[model samples]
Target: MSKKGKKPADSPATERPRPIASTVAPPPARSAPVTSASSPPTAPPKPTQAAPPDALIWFDKRVKITLGVFVGIFLLFVLFKWHYISLPAWNEILPDGGPAKRGLVAGTPKRIRMDDYAVGAPWILSNANTGFKTENEAVGGLKTPLLTLPVKHPIIIFKIGYWGFMFLDVERGYSWMYNSSPLILLLGTFLFFLLVSKNQYWLSLTGALTLFLSSGTVRWSFIPSSMIGYCGLAFVGAVYLLRSTNPKVYIPVAFGLIWIIVSFAITLYPPYQIPMAYLFIFLLIGYVLNERKLVFPPKSVLVKLISLAGALLVAGFVAYLFKSDVDETVKAVSGTVYPGKRSETGGTGFIANWYSEYYSWFFDDQQFPKGWLNICELSHYLNFVPVVSPLAIALFAFTRRIDWMLVGAMAFVVLMWLWMEVGYPEAIAKATLMSMVPTRRGQIPMGVGGIVLLFLYLAALRNVSLSDLKQAIPVWFTPVAIVGIVAFVVYTAYVNINDAEGMLRTDQTFMPVLFFILMNGLLLFSLNIRYRMALFCGGIILFLLPNLKANPLSKGLTPLTENLVYQNVKTLVDKDPDARWIVNGSQFVTYMVTATGAKQITGVKYIPNRKQIFSVLDPTMKRDSAYNRYAHVTFQTYINGAQGDTTILAQQYEDGYVIAGDPCSPKFKKLNVKYMLYDHAPQIPYEVRCMKKAVELGSMTIYERID
Candidate 1:
């Protein structure tokens, strides 16, 4: 402190600045302090921050470790799916029960040949086995990785059809491939949420698991028809397009438009008339601001009108093309009875009567009718399993776009119903039954509504909110959930029908009622993530345990002969591409030949046997089952549909390349047939004989077609 007795703190070099002169009196300055050499160096200026608690690296390391744990979980998810869930589901949906269930397991590959075979009428009839028959030929038959953007239209259609067709694997045939569109939409939407959400991992996982466990989704896997899938996909496309970034863009819009047009064509089939789904895209699009006008100067209002008109005109032209094509097809089929009419006489007569009863099913009734003939309707065929419509319908309010769309759908359905009942049909109820479009399937659309609501509910939650008190739920959603619960419970009970313990239960006589009950329960209202996981696991269990348990109703049956008609056709085709064989069975052969590589013969009916005649003939025709009478009628039918001269069965086979008669059947002996051709029958010797350990190649016995 030193110079002139001033302290070091008062020195000019060390002193702080004085306050402003006008505002306050100036402080005096002092001289610097003198030190010997230098005072022990003052400690360096103190750091500004307090020492961090322990090591900051710990927090960072924890974050990294947590991240690593999540990665591990994701890997685990993939592993579970690959090892225990998806792979098995794929296996199940692929062959014996799913994919490779045919008799040609050891067959040699023939070159893939493509063609639009001109099949005029149903031939090679064999409608007996409806179980898990659709083989997803496009996926299974065509050697391709993806279906989109194929060069050929038929191939494209086949590819698109395959995805939808193979998605569901049932006991017999596949549901419409169109349903895949909706499933695809659901998956896309789910993936979008998974990608954007804060808790993406769980959401992503849930999305993946969704396809594996969804019973409603899986139940439709193997339906032979593709119509339902298409209609549902139309809805899916509309929903997806409207929600997309560029609603006016051509890609999705084009797909949507084209699909709608395609949908209309397929809807001609009586079973596919789900008319309630009127395309309400215009209504939805009306809400979107046309970004096109923002960039370009606005055109006159009349230009908009003209554009709409032009678009309509183009659409009309396309419609005309489709109409022309269908007209040509219908011209060929003009004399034939529709599928429903055929069902009545061939085997499904009750189904025909039911559809013919009142044009449409009365779903609002306290109890919807369950008729054995209506094989396609869940109410009848799956009587023991039950039909759960309420569970899906109650979610109408909670679904985002669904409630409004459902309203439109309901209106459309009602309009269709009215048309059937009072407008379209003139002969009281009879005309309605015969001519009106099908529109009573409230289950699928309603089920979709429920699923959308569930998704919304799931998406709206935070991990904390869901974990904590229920206070965070939107006030409006609580009632929705309550309604859903009520609906779900109601439908569950409605569909929860009891099996009549009789010869019915005799086949699998010993299985507990609980097992069946649990299986049914799993199918109904079980779409949660965990439940889906369980389903995947359970499905795996079923595949692994191929128990040869028998149902007593089977009565210890055995096979008498093996009808290799399909195999026989394949052989004939292979022997000579031009060789034609006449099939006199049911509707089963058409699908089998189509799946395998055989062309349809004209001898069969699309809806075969007795059904065809009943459908076309006046109702006054008396029922007769005598073989000679049937033989005469069949012979005439063959002449009319194809060859002017009918080929006599016994005489044509003299060339030795033909087979005739049921080898072990009394009918064969009665017909006085010299040679035998094998066919499938769940009778005493046939079942046992057909099951002989056999290896099949491309040359595997398909069917023994009698010449």
Candidate 2:
């Protein structure tokens, strides 16, 4: 045979070539390399298998499902068996050793949130039994039934999750009260995962927990917290409808969009809602621009547009159904003297904005310094965005690339900070409709934006390599970022130190310092891809530290409802369902009376009743500014007025009023005041003779009108 045609001695000449495994394959196994006789033939090296994926990556793939299950179980347990409601705080007003004293299963209830314990909760429970209506007969007079559906007021019928439970049964709906905070947290986390993190489960959970557990959400865990979740849901729904090609997703997304819009509109808290709307608008624009290809494919454009338009039309129709009720409420609220026509140009509460998050941990049980704001007012999100902004700027500047989401988030936050720290012009404020957003209320958007910015920056960091970072960013950037962060922290500390009046103790500074260092450290680690998991885990830990004990884990509503005084009031109202009541003591008594289904003239007023209620007390309009606004009316007898006269003493507080009057007055009679709750006996004999005591427990006394 010719040498060129000859086969190797050990080869099977008839063996056919193996089929290629892929379009590209390793060069057909090379013939064994020629070996010298001196070197024994070595076994051909084994093909290398790919190293197993890192364990953490495996965990990451399933972590979302695992964490989701955990959250679901925790939610169900708390909703049915235990809750974190602050109803136990009502114990402070109950007589010592009274039959209905609220008991705690875990943490202490926060008295600082009387609005929740003494007012909002009672109103919700009362409304549950009385039927959810725009007008709550339990409060104000029947003709002037208090507007119970506005602001943070929780009318179960309008509340999303709670309303569903009411369909099952009223008790189930009532029990669902505890579900609000946890449900908000879950919704925020779930929606943020889809909207901001691109389904990055761990990052979304961390951000949501941090944001919702912050002082603002924990203390004002009603409208503000709900707004965050609803906004997130709306954004996610909009994005899904915009990008989805499947017909199955369209219906659910559309329904969710409608639900979120209606719920958000009904919330009626413009302070938080307006700023949040501005932030989301910025986010939506940036998101669309960034994901233009996915969100705006020409082939799917018609379907997407139709789906969105249909959803919005339905939502508009639903809103139109409530137009009459909403208009009446708007008119009543606008006519009030306090929050009515209240406009702001920002540049207020700067110190609180900067340092309140750090200092608020200490003030949860006590009043914040200056006594101008309570714990809830002082609460703010522990946002690391300010510290991380420099790093983000440097990254984008060096790489010559921009992340629109980060830019959008940073823009919103920066604008809010400017509005808060340096007053904005009145013209700009009015034009943007941000005048409705007081600087103090601006924290909601700023805090929410900070969290979004943090996660977006983290998502962006994943696309960057170490080589690109090293080549683009100078080594000195780390120290500069550290120094800037430290300076900001120190400035906040200094501001509080100067103004705290000994309230910010040295020991209290430890947590802020530790958290500052840890948070910045995690942001610094974001520069290196290898430490990404560490950064996420560490960030979650730091965020969780301050909020671990924010609320108590208690069971049931007995703490506020089962007491002897409440039962007695319930009995009295059961006999005379049409009777009206007036409380002559603490505002707590007023709300408690309202909780028993008794018509309370002095309960928290949702809107001023100028013509029927307030005008009767101040007919001459002498104190129109005082009685012409929302207030919790309290009565105190004074000898100055005629035997049956009343005078509005002061309306200095937005939510309260001091009225020096005789409960036996014709004004009270005209209002149909049939019962009086007192913390003390009347000192005036004439006032004493007007009513006879009917129920007494400890210091609280209930009297029936005798006139």
Candidate 3:
């Protein structure tokens, strides 16, 4: 019906109010153009993403591939050298040698005894005798609480077996187990340079030489902890280098590295583990932050991080099967042993020295006649020149020419050193949930970081010209160099003059100090000339020269398997396989007896069990004295022959060792010490008659118990 007043259906009002006249007009329709039907329909433009940066292309593809192949070959060479290639050298070292060839030097008791129990001997012995259980005889008859855990670096143990088995014939009593540690380090150093030096083969070679030949690396060459640390660092370098190649490969490579690093870390004690974990985290974070300018991490990066965290958690759980072992070690070490007691310079000595010694930088050789300082920790300074890396880092940072990655590395070095040397870092560590961390282990990172920083500094200097040096030194380079040289010279002169007049017989201080000064001077000159390559080569030379003289075989191990004392002890052990024995001689004698499969009344390396000590010692044994300090059921033994004297006999009783002169004593019987070897025998018929004679070898007289 047509009704405007009633809004008829045909009217404008009824026709949806003229479509409400849109305020925002619709897009104008295109006019129909006179085009042919043959024209193709236009396609829509495709969405695109920003291309990844190529700023990381430091090496040519050909060079990278060649070096990678070389690395593979080198690795193979090392493995072959460890196995088949060792034959020529073996034959040359000992003519007509069968399986029984000369092995590497017997190092300190920690290396000879503790390391063998931890990873070396157990692996060799287990493989040698199929029925031999490592768990039952780890570090002697008494079990090491830590070794019971799954975290004993089985990867390292397996690696040792794979590469060391051919040459290390346990049946023939070959003791070249520790020799592989140095070789591993050498391989690791090469890998580190290959990854980090950006295909600069010369730099890589120089760096490898500098690191492998460093006194610290040499001195602690026998320790798997140090070796593991180096390997972890090499993998870290690989991860850093590979992340830039392709994102598709980055995730898997990074994760793979995490697995390897964590595996290496978990196999050993905490000293190496904590630092490596920290380095991985730091490098990952720094890389992500530096690569992506975005403040917040992307979802992909977040996912990778979460995955890493989960993997690390799983690894940690697997490495330490039970947390109780770690806890027990913490509890024990915090009590009255060498770890807990006041050292020579007070407070746990150099081993657990919470405070760094002021003179640590000066000590290179700690061997008897050649060393100025006898401190073990100070050996880390071998061939290390005093150039103040922090100062250089600070200068670069202020100039804003420094890469953040290197800055982070240097920061780690400084942080680790401070953690080891100063009180504050350890205080913070203890205050946090990481209270169980042995702060001494921080030195691993310190050593590694220092080495890395040295390389980075040299790498940075490689590009600097004389003009750049002139501009960078800020008009004070020459005067500063002169002053530094003169100051060091004057300091050395004063030290030498004072030392010559002191109680020391021969003045060994001047030569080292002079060498140090000369090295610093040469480095400073190289800085002036921008000859970093020369300086690095000189550094290698400086590090290699002093430590070239091999570590003298640990006393009493001139010939490791065929020593006279070891043979005598082995005979007695072979007779009564079940009976325990005590050696009234040096720690080396104890080591020899233990190596021969004899169950020692007291352990050769570690502290003995407290309960065992209490069972054998007098009831009046003081809790705070040396007797208590030297007592444990595990590894504590007489350090040397201290028979006849009351205190020494008391110490022997406390340590669970038999009193040499009194084999018939109640304590000896209680401990079941069925045999004794007296190196410094007291000529008394009463004492001699108490035990049945079992032949004398050299200064030692073997005896069988006759109650």
How many steric clashes between backbone atoms does each model show? 67, 1, 11
Instruction: State, as a TM-score between 0 and 1, how close model 1 is to the true structure.
Output: 0.40
Ten residues in sequence with the least summed lDDT for candidate 3: 15-24
Model 1 agreement with the true structure over 1-707: per-residue lDDT tens digits: 01222222212222232211101112344445555666775545422221121111112233335445544653443332211101111121212222321222222211110010111101101211111222111111111112111122232242443432233221111112223333343343333333222123343334333322332233233121234334434443443333333324324444554555454444344432333233233212321222223223432334334444555566566556545534533433333322222211011122222111111122211223354222223321111111223322433222222323223333443443344234443353243232333322333332333333232223322221222323333556545544544443444333323221121222232232333344334432223234442453354234222211100001000100022334444444455443323233322333334332332222222321222222222133332222111111111111222533222332122111111223333332233222211223323444223223222323222333232
Model 2 RMSD, rounded to 1 decimal? 9.9
- In terms of lDDT, the poorest run of 10 residues in model 1 is 551-560
Least lDDT summed over 10 consecutive residues: which range in candidate 2?
15-24
Alpha carbon lDDT at 328, candidate 1: 34
Kindly report the root-mean-square deviation of model 1 from the true structure over all alpha carbons: 19.5
lDDT per residue as tens, model 3, 1-707: 11122221221111121111111122234554555689876554332221232122234343346446544653553433322111122222222323233432332222212333323332333223322333323132233423422123333332342333344344322223444455555556555554444334566556665555554555554353334445645455444433434455455555555565654544545555556556545644544444454323333565456556765576566556434445554455546445453221111222422212212333333322122243344444332323546445544643455455456666676566555545343456654323344444445445666666566555444433445345556557656765776575546445434432342222444554555565556545225544446665675566465554324332112233455555666676677766767666554455455556665654332433455534455446554345334333222223223553232333444343333235455566676778876666745556545588787765667788878
Model 3: per-residue Cα lDDT at residue 551: 44
Model 1: how far residue 18 lies from native, Å: 57
Best of the two (1, 2) by lDDT: 2
| Candidate order by decreasing lDDT | 2, 3, 1
* Every candidate's lDDT: 0.29, 0.65, 0.45
